[model samples]
Target: MPSGHANAGYRRLFDRSGLTFGAGFPLTGTNRSTPDPEAEIELAKHAESVGFDGLWARDVPTYWPKFGDAGQTFDTWPWLSHVAAHTDEIALGTSSVVLPLRHPLHVAKSAATVDRLSDGRLVLGVASGDRDPEYPAFDVDPDSRGELFRESVEALRTVWREDYPELEDRWGRLEGDLDVVPNPTEETIPLLPTGNSRQSDEWIAEHGDGWLFYHLPESTLESYIRQWREATADKPFAIAIRVELADDPAAGPEPLHLGFRAGVEWYRDYFRRLEGYGLDHAIVGLQNDDRERAFETFAAEIIERV
Candidate 1:
């Protein structure tokens, strides 16, 4: 949270929690037919005011029209820009931009712009895209995404940190004295790879600044964390989770993929568990099963509690 924004509140909260807490956005009102950007901005501002560490946005291309759970359901860059302009202190993150479906040069340019605009609060999350519908539209082979994703990441680094370097990659080639303008602070944006994306655990630990994983039982989660720590031996780790709150604190566990449907007390206890596991960040996606009630209830009982 040591961002370009000159807000000491950001620094204080980060220092006190020793963990990054965030909320995913595009708060689609359950009964509303479409998203309202203005309303969303208000929600984002509220999240920041309440001392959340970061805010995450998801890219939902095509929505497949039926993915049912389109987190942000918007173009990644535009949404990030909108949020970055409005927020003064909280770190802005993309859950991930599917690298294989995009040109890394474009990503590099756009991300750097956001970083500069936000005073260096951008943390890019990249992944080998899933959702087969998008592959055909982009002319990207889903099967080859792993290789393309790897190459794109390399290309981004070249364009950002080097000038006029000879670049050779499966995607294409670049030569001459050229570099992406307005490089991000630190000379690079932190690249957090979601899941494995066909990269081995060791490979991820070696290359990624952090690993993004779905929720898991603490023991299982710790095992994966241990593997990453052993492999990296010199880097940090990050993790995230999704949760749906029941008005009742004892609502009990209901099955949710990579997450859970529970109560405020349960959520706080679980977050404490994750922190105990040495997680540096936790981005919670508030499920939309009950929309308004869920948002208000969780924000009051759980979000503030954490």
Candidate 2:
């Protein structure tokens, strides 16, 4: 496939319909429990069956004592690898991997491996480190993550694109005959940026394949997206919603940090507004206290509705 200009995966979610929706991890750490992929696989298959555009996995390197939620409680890559084989068509993604914490070369290698195994259906999202506790444990400075993230993205691009791609960055060197084998199906894989990561608008506009924005009201979503367009002026914009769906359509809106609790009707209406706002994608974060019930209800209700 020709890379960098336009491709099927990018065009499907980022171009056509102007609305790409995907389910975040159905499990977000409740009830002293962790997500079981075997159990989750049934739900994933259901999602694919129901026509969700994609499924996103997250990387939580540590469970912080201060942080109440435990996330999906699995290393992201292994989970993605397992599910990629189990399902047939749904695309796989990472809401984000903390790039500053890992070597970019390793990330390139792993991403390429998953993309190859899945037959070129990997969309990698990356970000600077957020958990303050994690930075020290890895002997990396949280304050300097923005710089590291830029370096990491650049390094990964080099390794993915050219054989022993020449390096001229603050990160390091890839001197002689080194190369990352099995370059992505496209000349490169899509690298979606999460948040600002301390990058200037120019840097983001120039480098980011797509942009991820967190929690915005319908109107706010419109304004932010407009601003992103004005800033980047040429790139695609993707947004994420932290959603908790209730069984009843009239359950009303309750507050979560970056999301809300609403019923299926409201969910549909709200998403429609986002589509009108020119939002390209909405990655829904499902944070149901009841795991099995949440997945089942969403599949029957919203996923089926979409």
Candidate 3:
């Protein structure tokens, strides 16, 4: 198997040599249904201009208002394509696309299209979805999501790697007579399975090109990284963290749901420590009122220092 460096998006976000960083969307920092798209675009451009390695988006097929956050509100493919058109070299990614809700072939075509449009800067982070209502909304059986997720992943790889590949399972059959077009810029798109997606650690280690996890406590995070390193050789391990940069440069870390609040200096050392533990990448969601300045500040202080 070829390493992630073979894929441009994967290369931008991961390196066996050290850890890299990316910024996640809803960059506007809005928790509501409508985030300012124009503002988000400018922030995306700003992030790239300031040397952020990648720009990531979320896939929320249907927003249940109860969920509280709308996650960028735009559908994944077109939004990423639009971003691709505006940016030049920054990697484009999905924080995750729910695999079980969508047909594998559609995911293949859309993902390949983004990869082609972006000149191979697309890296897929796929998940099985968490919301209970979301499954029934898609006419998907909740109990079978694990199987569906596995089948979807295998299907994606098969279609991307082989032209008109024969495939059969939950979604009918492809008889090797018809093909999905616009293959990924590499032999295969970099596939990072988000969280467990109902799969075991062993399954994720074997099938995923990388692993995307949420923020964990320092000890737990270190343990996961160590276990991942032992199980998979050279594959990247990534985490998406919510960041709240305190005004004090030396403030200690306080917990958030999937991340923490701390001073830039602490973050710098924390990331360095993570790098020492063999972590490869981090996707940050900046939770600050003045996010633009926070981005510049973090980039200058934390990113540069790290």
Candidate 4:
């Protein structure tokens, strides 16, 4: 189950048996953009201390009032760097960065720098832009994002693997002179494509080191896992799950839009079923105000046992 990169994050994710869990940020789970920064850093450290395998950050360039969630409220690189300084052993990852909104060169340089700083613990998840307003904001045509995403993924591989390799793309042209440095701690970092990003499933399985998907229904997820396994044997499949841990251990599962509200035993069984169906990782987001209690309880009862 090696995902080509020996980076700690990649290994922790793809090289494991069954499913391991990670905490998604903001650990506080506030619906708004602004969160207490100090609290977030502290919770991040606490999450690692309690045996979570990884910490994930989201890439939200701007806060849209209509969308109602600003996603960790900090640029992915700087915020993750701050957290990286405080924790050891816990892998750091971008739940995803929107590739179509950014210049590939900048994305490569920033990601590689973080990979180096984290000592090969970074797992980069990339995606095409989703919001329609975002396309206009970035002066990009909405229809062109799919191709842009493909080109960005290609550009990232080129810049990271070769020094000043000649390439031309929608963003710019590279003439084999200037290079994006400092190289990652490994030969290159792993690139997990989030969702379809407007590409065919075959295209994602072909190019992605792994796949980052959102929560899906049981039968649908099982079907997706089957398709992914058939296309790329042993490539990782991960999803972000919203968890509401009920106090009673015996509580049955009550579904949320993209996750579940249940007690530890139910979640344990639920994750085990997903693991049995070939899911490698579950990025859990605790949607409770008492995040500390929820995190500790979830880890002790579910993560420890599972």
- Which one wins on lDDT? 3
How many clashes in candidate 2? 0
lDDT of 4 by residue, 181-276 (tens): 988887778888998899999999988889999999999999999999999996899999999988788999999878989988898888888988
lDDT of each: 0.72, 0.75, 0.90, 0.88
Cα distance off (Å), candidate 3, residue 295:
0.6
Among all candidates shown, the one with the greatest TM-score: 4
How many clashing pairs in candidate 4? Answer: 0
Alpha-carbon RMSD of each model: 3.7, 2.8, 1.5, 1.1
For candidate 1, write residues 285-304 as lDDT tens digits.
76756554565666567556
Which pairs of residues collide in model 1?
Answer: none
Tens digits of per-residue lDDT for model 3, 82-132: 999989899999989999999999999999999999999999999999878
Error of 4 at 78 (Å): 0.3
| Cα TM-score per model | 0.86, 0.89, 0.97, 0.97
Which prediction has more favorable lDDT, 3 or 4?
A: 3
What's the CA RMSD of model 4 in angstroms?
A: 1.1
lDDT computed for candidate 2: 0.75
Give the residue spans of candidate 2 off by over 4 A: 1-8, 26-33, 168-170, 289-306
Candidate 1: segments with Cα more than 4 A from true spot: 1-17, 29-34, 288-306
